[model samples]
Target chain A: MKLSILKNELNEAIQNVSRAISSRTTIPILTGIKVDVTFQGVTLTASDTDISIQSFIPIEDDRQTIVQVERPGSVVLPAKFFVEIIKKLPSQHIEIEMQDQFQTLLRAGSAEIQMVGLDPEEYPVLPSIEEEQVFSVNGDLLKTMIKQTVFAISTNETTPILTGVLWNLQDGELKFVATDRHRLASRAAHIEVDTELRFHNIVISGKTMNELSKIIPDQNTMVDIVVADNQVLFKIDHVLFYSRILDGTYPDTSRIIPNQYKTELVLDTKKLTEAIDRAYLLSREEKTNIVRLQTKEDGTIEISSSSTELGRVTEQLEVKQFNGEALRIAFNSKYMLDVLKVIECEHIFLGFTGAMSPIIFKSTENVNSLHLILPYRTTT
Target chain B: MKLSILKNELNEAIQNVSRAISSRTTIPILTGIKVDVTFQGVTLTASDTDISIQSFIPIEDDRQTIVQVERPGSVVLPAKFFVEIIKKLPSQHIEIEMQDQFQTLLRAGSAEIQMVGLDPEEYPVLPSIEEEQVFSVNGDLLKTMIKQTVFAISTNETTPILTGVLWNLQDGELKFVATDRHRLASRAAHIEVDTELRFHNIVISGKTMNELSKIIPDQNTMVDIVVADNQVLFKIDHVLFYSRILDGTYPDTSRIIPNQYKTELVLDTKKLTEAIDRAYLLSREEKTNIVRLQTKEDGTIEISSSSTELGRVTEQLEVKQFNGEALRIAFNSKYMLDVLKVIECEHIFLGFTGAMSPIIFKSTENVNSLHLILPYRTTT
Candidate 1:
């Protein structure tokens, strides 16, 4: 195979596929990037069994000539050195030619390199995802959904299914939910889809979702997501991202969210976030990350935390509005911070059922997203 | 200690001294920062035995009232948590008061914190320097000299002295040299000082030099260097940086640099740097880091490297001048790259005595800096 590709185009493609290449992979061939030169364009693929990413550099682009293909062939080159070499090469134009026995030669400017290539056949094929249930979403909205819910996914691998975000579609509304048993984050969007289409319990690992978010251009581009049986494919322009779905049913959590709240507090998101962070400083010292919130008789909210080795922190913040019964409750500050950061609103609504029940936060500016955190029992 | 300090001023002071705090230090108190509030102002100090840094916050400044000292006392607070807490506090003005048993109360806005503080008596005392021998140098020049030589210091701890940069003063000139046996870097600067004062050898650990480089404001501030028997103190305004000198003497490296060269090759520093970097890509794959440089018949320099598992890379770089007999030499590309990165020159003079002799590089822009790299021996 022989091809002449622009350095910028090739480098961008390598970076996209490299997300799936890991040195920790058990399979030796999985450590290399598969390069294929065809009549249409050049394709680079990398995989770690958990996910596979393939990026194509077309022969001609509207902005510039990205690639020039002369022959057709395929080879897998060690990704560890290939990426570094390409980045440091001196020339704008690079020529790569495969010789006898899969030996690859890379020439850029006055420098020429011949890298030993492994058989591309040894690499696993792309997951056969039949675009049966495909839907497109705007890159910006999709990215926001990932950021709003992915952090709530369980990092503990004991419950493998909970480590993934559940995707649900009904009545033309697309929703994403993730929970680590301690906290839950949910985001919804009104997307155009087939009137008869309905998907439930389509769980995708948080790791894969994060990788997809990175590759998806943060512009107004449309990202097409295809689901077939146990595999999901996300196509962002010339890039294709595929991942396996978690094999388990999502637990019913609808009953956990209360329709009515015993107490509601409305406050500036930035002010509340800062108060919690200050209280977190002391709670973090205790290693439990526990902080208490109390509603004062003046309608102000009190946040405090204490540690035996350290000391204690107490903060009082005035809320815009406070009604119903005054309550005191303890919760993990980490969950609160994570929820606050994703909120893009000046004010937020905090609804509480009781001391032992879940506390929910809803952004006043963005009504489509909400976060719920479970309160921790306090011995005192 | 009782003080009302501007939040920004306190945060900046803590950051400056926190560089000396090490989580891996064996001494527990060394991991904390000692805060002393006197009638004048507040001082923060952190130490790791090898190095200690202290930064002072003045009572008043042109911009604002930086510190207001009410009572005088001292306490050592854990640097790790203190730095984070100070950065996240909500108020522009912060008041800190030391209560019973060294329990410190920090108030910012509506938030108040009580952090456990270690006894100041447990912290190590700062080294007392008489400033018997003192010289001041421009902060910019000092930082540049360090960058040009510190990377050559040996990382291996077996030869403790080689891990330090040797500072020698003579004939109104200050010189710095560092060598890891395989490579050596030398830099010299002429400065106005005591006409009759000179020091033969003073070795300061490279680690301390790096930390000092960071603390010295990037502007044109004058830094006073005070040398005692075993300790060196750098004073930048009210901030005092103290570091202990390494034991033993630095070897004389003057005799090894040859005056006459068998081959002299002058090349564009930027072009040669890029070419060598490309060759380095392949050499890194072989782990030997051996790259070949030979004078071609056309008067251009040919650079190449090959590996059994990988392949090979070859490049021809145009030389501005190549005289003497045609020569071939092999050297570690990593050392050359390190020197290239620090050189602020458009062209470089490469002097070669022989294939096995040490190669020397001198920047055409600056004559004060010189780098020497020992060549590698190959069977071929």
Candidate 2:
């Protein structure tokens, strides 16, 4: 490859592709990043077998020249050194040329670096999927959906399928669900899609979703996702991300959600979050993480936690609205805090069927999202 | 204790003293912070048997009420819980009261917390040093001096004295020196003090100096230093720090620094730093960290490093002035980079005696500071 590229533009493209390069890969060539230069643009690709990422830089962006090509060629350079050297280059313009036997020369201002590059043919090819089943979603909404549901996925390796989030599409509604049996988070959005084009039981690992979220633009852009029989591809502007789908079927969770609530209370989200956080500090010391909540006749709730070594924490929070019977329930304070953190609304509505049933949490303003946590049955 | 204190003021004091509390201490009571409240003010103290830090908050400062005291008492609470709770408290005004049996009650807004407190009598008392030998320096100058020399201290525990920075005070000139046998850094400043006061062989651990540097204000405020026989105390605005001096005689480092130079070159500090940093990336991979420098007959210098597996990095840099004979020298690039990072001047002057002797680095604008790095003897 013989080309002169803008330092800032090339550096950003390298960083995006480097997210898929894993240091512990068993294959030697997998540790290097593949670079291909043509008349149209320059492309950088990296893979760790499980996931692959590719970023392309066009010749011009908004009338500003980003690259000037002298020749078209391909080579693979060590990601560890290439990434660091590109970031610390001293000048705004960099020239890269390939020499005899795949020797690569890079010049940035007065500094010149030479490295032995691997043959591009030695690198593994990324899986290509037919783009028949594809759907587009707004980038901001996609990131929010991933953030709201990905944290509840199971981390255990015994049940491999539980480590991924389940994706279901019906009519024009797309829904995501993740659960580790103790707690579950579900988020849904209405996307423009054909009514006949629907898919279910498609699961993607939580880790892959996190990496995709990072590359997605924060503004209101469109992201296209193509689903294949075994692999899925996500296209975000100039970047392409591919991941393998889990093999086993996801567990059915629709029956576990209670259809009715015996008691429902609406309270300010910030007040409840702070009260549980303080109680969590003490309950965490006891390793039980259990906090008690009791409703009184005066339309107030008491939140408290105690440890044998440390003393106790108690707070009385007023509820905006209360209905049904008064009840006392104990639940994990850490789990409750996690659910409350993702709630962006000012008020939250909590529904309880009984002491042993799952407690439902929903943002007062948004009806498309809900969280469920199982209550702890304490003898006290 | 019964008082209402401003949350921000108390939180700052707690954070300052919490730096002295060590989690690995053998003594159980040392893990807790001792709090003493009196009509005059409130003092927070924490110690790890090696160093003690105390911060005092007066009843009122500059006509603003910081603490309103109704009773006088003292208690010891676990530093881990107390520090975190105070930061996350929901209100600006916090009321603390001492209940029966050493139990403490803290109320902020609607949340109430009760913590089991240890007996204040069980806590070890801080060492009382006589303030006979005293001097003062600007806090900003002291912080700068510490940063310039502390990184060269030997981390190995076999030679206990080398782990501390040597302090020499004579004729109102205060000097600090640190060396690990391979590299040395020295910084000196003139303070207004008794000309007859001379002290030597005083060494304080690098770790303690780092912690003290963090607490020192970045602004130009006078800080008093009292040097006792075996302990040193630093008094900042409202904080007092006590540290035990290291035992042993420091080695003499004067003989290693050459008084004469055969070659001297001046170059821009930023350009040299960037050149050495790029070469360091390759040399670090070879595990030798060796970079070669040679003065050219054409009035320029070449800096390069090569690895057996990876290739090489070479850069030709221009010097502002070149004096004496042409020379080639090799040294650890990591050490050279470390010295260059601390230089605040725009231009740096390098003095070399020979290819194998010590190379000196000094800021062209400052006369009170200098750094020395022993060159590596390589056959090439």
Candidate 3:
């Protein structure tokens, strides 16, 4: 490939594609980034069997010349070295030309780098995804939904299905759910989609979802998602991200969430987070991460944690509003902290069915998001 | 200790002393920070055997009331947990009280923490230095001198003396030098001190120097340094930093620097750094970090590095002035980058004796700082 491209645009594209490259891949060529140059634009692709990312740089973007082509060609260069060189290149524009025997020459300012490139044919071909069952969601909203639920996914590989976040769609409402058996997080959003389109058992690995979240544009642009039987493709602007769907069945977490609560309290999100965070420090020493919460009739809640070696942390937080019966519950403060951080609201509604039942946390302002954690049984 | 101290002041003091607390220490009491409250103010101290740091907060500083003493007492609190708790405390003013049996109660806003404290008597006492040899240097200058030379210290503990930076003071000139037998960095500053007071064999561990650098105030305030028999004490503002001197004779590095040069070139420090940095990226892949530099007769230089598996990178840089025999030299680009980064000057002078001899780098604007890296003997 012979072309002169804007250094900034190419650098950004390489970084996005590099997120998919893994050094642990047994296939040597998979460790490299495949570059394709054409009259239309330049495309960079990287994959590690599980996930593949492709980023394209158009010849012209918004009246600015991003790439100028002299010849069209294809080659795969080592991703590790190529990524580092491109980021440290010294010029505003860089010229890349394919030499004899798969050798590539890159010239930026006064620096010239000749990198050994592998034949593009040796690289695995990305599966051509058909947009038969495609749906679109706002990039920002999709990112929020992933953040709110992905962390709850189980990291244990023995139960492979639990390592992914379940995506369920019904009646134009798309919902995401993830649980590690101990805690569960669920978020749903109403989107403009075909009422007949429905899928309930689709699960994407939590790790892949995090990588996809990194590339998603911060802007509120719409992203098209194509779901296949075994693979899912996300078309985000000029980038195409493909992730393999995990096999096996995801357990139904809907029944785990408490439908009714005997005690509920509304508290300032920041104040409660601070109180729990302090209590978390002491509980972490004991390694149990157990923190006790008790509601008072005087419209206040007590949060405390103790360690045999470190002593105790106690805080009385005034609730904005309280209803139902007074109760005391013990839970993993780390899990509670994680749920509170993602609430993104001024106040949060904490509901308790009983000390042994699951405690549900929901944003006071947004009804679409919900999080639940199982209480720890302790003899007090 | 019963007192109400400004949270910000106490937090800063805790953070400074916490640097000296190492969890790897075998002594259990050393892992805790000792707090002594008097009518004057509060003092926080932590030590890991090698280094001890003490910070004192007065009853009032300037016009602000930093501390109000309720009672005089002493206690040792777990450094790891106490440091984290104080940082997240909710109030501007935190009240600390000593309860029965060495239990400490900390109240800040609505949060209350009762921590199990250790007996202050069990904590090791800091050595009282007689200050037979004393000198003062600006905190900013001392920090700069440490940063410029400390990176060259040998990290291998086999030769424990080389792991420390050699501090030599003579004739009102304070000099610091560190070398790993491959590269040597030396910095000297003329300070207003008694000319008769001289200590040439003192060496302090590079790790302790780094810890001391962290507590040095950014402002250009004078810091008094006392050199005792086996201890060095630095009074930085209200913080007293004590570092144990390494027991060994420091190797003389003056003979390693090239006094005469066969080739000398001057160039912009930043440009040379950028060129070397790019070449270092490729050399790093080879694991040898070898980069070649050749001076041209036309006042220019070429910097390049190659990997057998990854290919080559070459860059030609124009020199401001070149007046020496045309010669080619190979050296570790990583070492060259380190020296260039600390030059802190617009222009740098590169002095070379031959292709295999030591290469000296000095700031053209600063005469007191010098760096030398032994060149790699490569056949090509």
Candidate 4:
């Protein structure tokens, strides 16, 4: 294979595909990025047996002309070294040519690097999926949904199914849910899709979802998600992402959410978030990272935490409204802080069923995002 | 102690002193910052046995009152927690008052933090210097000298004295030297001092020198360096820094540097440095990180490296002048790279004695900075 490409274009494509390459892969060829040249353009592919990423650079761009293909062939070169050399090359254009007996030459400016390449046939092939069950959604919305719920998924490998996020679609609405049995996060959004088409359940590994979130641009561009029996493909502008689906049933989380509450309070989200953050700094030295919340009859909420080894911190904030009876409860400050950060709202309402029950946190402006945290039992 | 100080001022002072406080100290009181309040100002001090830092916030600055002293007393509070709370306080001015025994109250806006304090008597007292052998130097010059030599100091504690940078003064010139027995770096600058006052030898730990470099201001500001029998003090404007001197003799590095060479080459510093850096990246995969350099009779230098596991890289650079006979040498690329980065000149002259001897890198514009790197013996 002999080709010359713009340095900037090649750098961007290499970085996108490098996210899927793992240095510790058991498959030797998996540690390299496969490069293929054709009349259409050049394509780069990388995979780690779980997720595959492929990016294409056209022959011509507005800024410069890239990828002049002299001959068409395929070769796999080391990913880490190739990326570093391309990034540090001091020229606008770079030339990569593969000679006989798997010798790859990369030249840019005064620097030239010769590396050994592996046969492209040794690399694993990416799974293919049909476009029949495909749906389109804005990249920004999908990124937001993943960021909000992916962090709540269980990281432990003992419960393999719980390490994935559950994606459900019906009618014109899509929903995402993640839980670790201690805390849960759920988000829903409306997207344009075929009215007759429906997906009852699809669970994707949290690790794969997190990687997709980074590779997909967080803009208004639309991305087509194609779902098959065992493979999932996400097609963006010039990039294609594929991940394997987890083969297990996700537990039903609908019954775990509290339907009613005896106590409720509404307050500005930013103020409460800052107050909780300050309290967390003080409570980090104590076990459970406990912080207490008390609602008074005079429409004020006081947050306090004290550690015998460190110090004590108490903050007071005014509540907009309160319903039912005034009460005091304690819970993990970190969990509450994470929930508040993802709500993205001006006003938040918190509902409590009792002193020793799970509490619900929801935004007044948007009803799609919800967070639930279990309260800690305090002796006092 | 009782006082009300501006939150910004308090935060800055706490941050400065906290750098000297280490959580792993054997002495419990060393983990706390000593806060002393007087009618004129409030002072905060923290020590980690090796170094001590003190910062003062006066009652008035430019006729503006910043600190209000309610009572004259001293107490020690946990350094880490107090700094965190002061940084996050939601008010312009913070009120701090000691109440009862071992309890300190901190108030700012609607946030209140009560922390446990230790008795001030338990804290280690800073050593007092006579200030008889004191000399002043420009803060910028001192900072520059520290940065150039401190990075070469030995990090291993096998030879305790090698971990310190040697500071020597003679004939109105101050010189700094650091070496790990493998490579050495020396820097010097002219300074005005009393004719009768002299400091022949002093060794300060590399870690302490690094800490002082961060707080010293740039420009023509003067800093007084006072040498006591067992401790050294730096009085920079209002802040005071004290460090315990190392208790051993530093090796004489003058004999290791070659005064004459069999071959010499003059080249642009920037081009030479970049070529060496690129060679270093390729040599990193080898066992010794060795790169070979050859000066030819045609006024050209070649840099190359090859690893058994990795491939090979060769780069050619033009030399402005070459004297003596053609020569070839090998050395650790990392050591040479570190020394090259500290050079402050556009052009550098390299002098080599032989294949197994040390190579000296000196700047053509400045005679104060010198780097000596020992060559590695190559089998091929």
- Native contacts retained, all candidates in order: 0.91, 0.83, 0.93, 0.59
Please tell me which model should have the higher lDDT, number 1 or number 2: 2
Docking class of 1: medium
Please provide, for model 1 over B61-137, each residue's C-alpha lDDT reduced to its tens digit, 9 standing for 90 to 100.
88788888899999998788899989998888999999999999999998888888999998888999997899999
DockQ values of all predictions: 0.74, 0.78, 0.89, 0.69
lDDT: worst 10-residue window of model 4 chain A: A107-116
lDDT tens readout by residue for model 4, B167-278 = 9988888999999988998999888986666675599999999999987876577888998998999987668999999998988888888889999989988888877777
Cα lDDT of all candidates, in order? 0.91, 0.93, 0.94, 0.87
lDDT of 3 by residue, B1-380 (tens): 68899899999999999999997998989989999999998999999989999999999988899999989999999899999999999999899999999999999999999999999999999999997888899989999999999999999999999999999998899999999999999999999999999988899999999999888979888899999999999998899999999998998777777688888899988888999999999999899999999976666899999998898999999998887799899999999999998889999999998998999999999899999999999998
Can you give the lDDT of residue B146 in candidate 3? 97
Which candidate wins on DockQ?
A: 3
Ranking by DockQ: 3, 2, 1, 4
**Alpha-carbon lDDT of model 2:** 0.93
Q: Which pairs, if any, clash in model 2?
A: none
Considering only chain B, report the TM-score of each candidate against the true chain B: 0.98, 0.98, 0.98, 0.98
